[model samples]
Target: MLIDTHCHLDDPTLLASLPEILAAARGAGVVKYIVPGVAPEGWDGIARLAEEWDGVCPAFGLHPMFAGLYDEILLTRLRSFAGRAVAIGEIGLDYLAEVPRERQQAAFRGQLRLAVEAGLPVMIHCRRAFQDLLAILREEHVQRVGGVMHAFSGSPEVARECIGLGLYISVAGTVTYRNAVRPLEVVREIPLEHLLLETDAPDMTPEPHRGRGNEPAFLVEIARKVAETKGVTVEEVTAATTRNAVRLFRLS
Candidate 1:
């Protein structure tokens, strides 16, 4: 079975048709999902979904892209929610976001500290900010609790560094794209044990379904691509990645 380590099932598009979507995913052999919070307001709904569904796990945090929405009170609220969450993220720095570097850093650091204190793994999102993200993670000693780099879009060298830090590198639908040169390289270079798969649902749609909203069912496409890149059977890819996700998220 496959576990999509990152997917925004809380997003309105997916949430609206959750039963049908989840059934389709199960048919595709994608048995579990990790739903992450991008904003404080969304945390309650994500928590609700995890409680209501069998294979849905919840993670809470503010996305770097939503840095402007973070505040001290939200951190307090996040702490209260942490005990019920599988991880404290989809959090990290995104240089491409229009938000100031300082603001993003503030939110990232705050969440990292919370993760450490809460003893929960993290689900990080990074874009064009690996240097800063690596530095902050090191300073925070994130290796203590460990985590996964959501939709990792980094170099092979960076992938190695993240694994060194005790983090799994999650590959997304982009790995299936014909132009996914870097993702192909990363998958080839990284060991299967350090890898996970995701769809980033309602976005990052894979080939033959690139224009449609992505969902957990499409994770099979990513698994197939990773298997092709690593020269392994698709079952091997799914088993290894599912094991990796269960370890990171402490799935039952």
Candidate 2:
């Protein structure tokens, strides 16, 4: 069985058709999904989905894109929601966007502390800010509860850094694109034992399916590409990644 380690199933576009989407995912051999929240507003919806679906797990946190929406008041609310979540996540830096770097840094650090305090793993969302993120993680001594780096698009060196901190590197549909040499390279370089697969559904659709709305079902193509890159069978990739997901999230 395959596990989608990072996906936003709570997005309205996808959530509206839950049964069909989940059926398609299961048809593709995707037996489990970890749906990480994008903002405080999305936490409840994600949690509710997890409660309703046997294979879905919830992760709550403020995404970097919505960092400005977070405030001190949300901390208590987050603590309550996180109690039911598998991890604290979809949180980190996004230098690719216009959000002020300092503000994003503050928000990321705050959530990191929250995850540390809650004693939960983090599902990070980093983009073009690996060095800064790594520095902050180091400073915070945030190695206690390492988690997955969602949609990882960094160099093998950066992947090593994250692995050093006990974090897993998740490769998404981006790896299926022919132009995604860097991501593919990282996939080959990182050991399968530390790798996880994701689709980042409703986005990052793999080749031949590009321009179409992505779904968990497309994770098969991502896994196929990873298997090819690593010179392993699809079953091996699926088994290793599923094992990594269960171990990382402490899922049953």
Candidate 3:
């Protein structure tokens, strides 16, 4: 079985098509999922999804693109989740979007602090802000509860750096693309143990299924690509990545 460590099942599209999405995911051997919240408004939805599904884990945090929605009140509420939240995430810096840099940094640090205080791992979303992301993670001492760099598409050097800081690099469906030069290179350089698989569904649908809404079920194709990149069997990639997720989130 495989675990999709990152998915946005709470999104309207995925939520509206829940039954079909999950059925296809199960058909692909994706037995578990981790859905990350984008803002306070959606936290409850993520929680409800986990409650209704057998193996769905939820995380609460403010996305960089939506940093404007963050406030002290929100941080306090997120902190209250503690053990109930699998991790404090999909949080991190996103320079690609039009949000203010300062607000993103503040929210990222606040959520990172929340994760440390809660003693839970993190699920990070980074885009075009590698150095800034690493700086904050280092200053915050994320080693306490190592997190995963969701949708990681960086060089092998950057991957090694994050690993050194006690973070796992999660590969998404982009790895299945023929022109995915950077992600494929990173996967080849990093060991399977440090890797986690995700579909980042409702967004990056793998090739052959491109133009369609991404879903957890597409995880098998991503895993197959990971196996090919690492020169190993898909079974081995599945076992290692699942163990990494279970250990990182302390999943039952």
Which candidate comes out best when scored by TM-score?
A: 1
lDDT of each: 0.94, 0.90, 0.91
lDDT of 2: 0.90
TM-score of each: 0.99, 0.98, 0.98
Report the Cα lDDT for residue 235, model 1: 92
Candidate 2 residues 140-235, lDDT tens each? 767898888999989999999999998999999888787788998899899999999999988999987998889999999999999999999999
Index of the highest-lDDT prediction: 1
Residue pairs in clash, model 1: none
For residue 5, model 2's alpha carbon misses the true position, in angstroms, by 0.8
Global fold similarity of model 2 (TM-score): 0.98
Segments in model 1 whose C-alpha atoms lie over 4 Å from true places? none
Arrange candidates by lDDT, descending.
Answer: 1, 3, 2
**Candidate 1 local lDDT, 1-252, one digit each (tens):** 999999999999998999999999999999999999999889999999999998999999999999998889999999999989999999999999999999999999999999999999999999999999999999999999999999999999999999989899999988888788999999999999999999999899999798889999999999999998889999999889999998989997
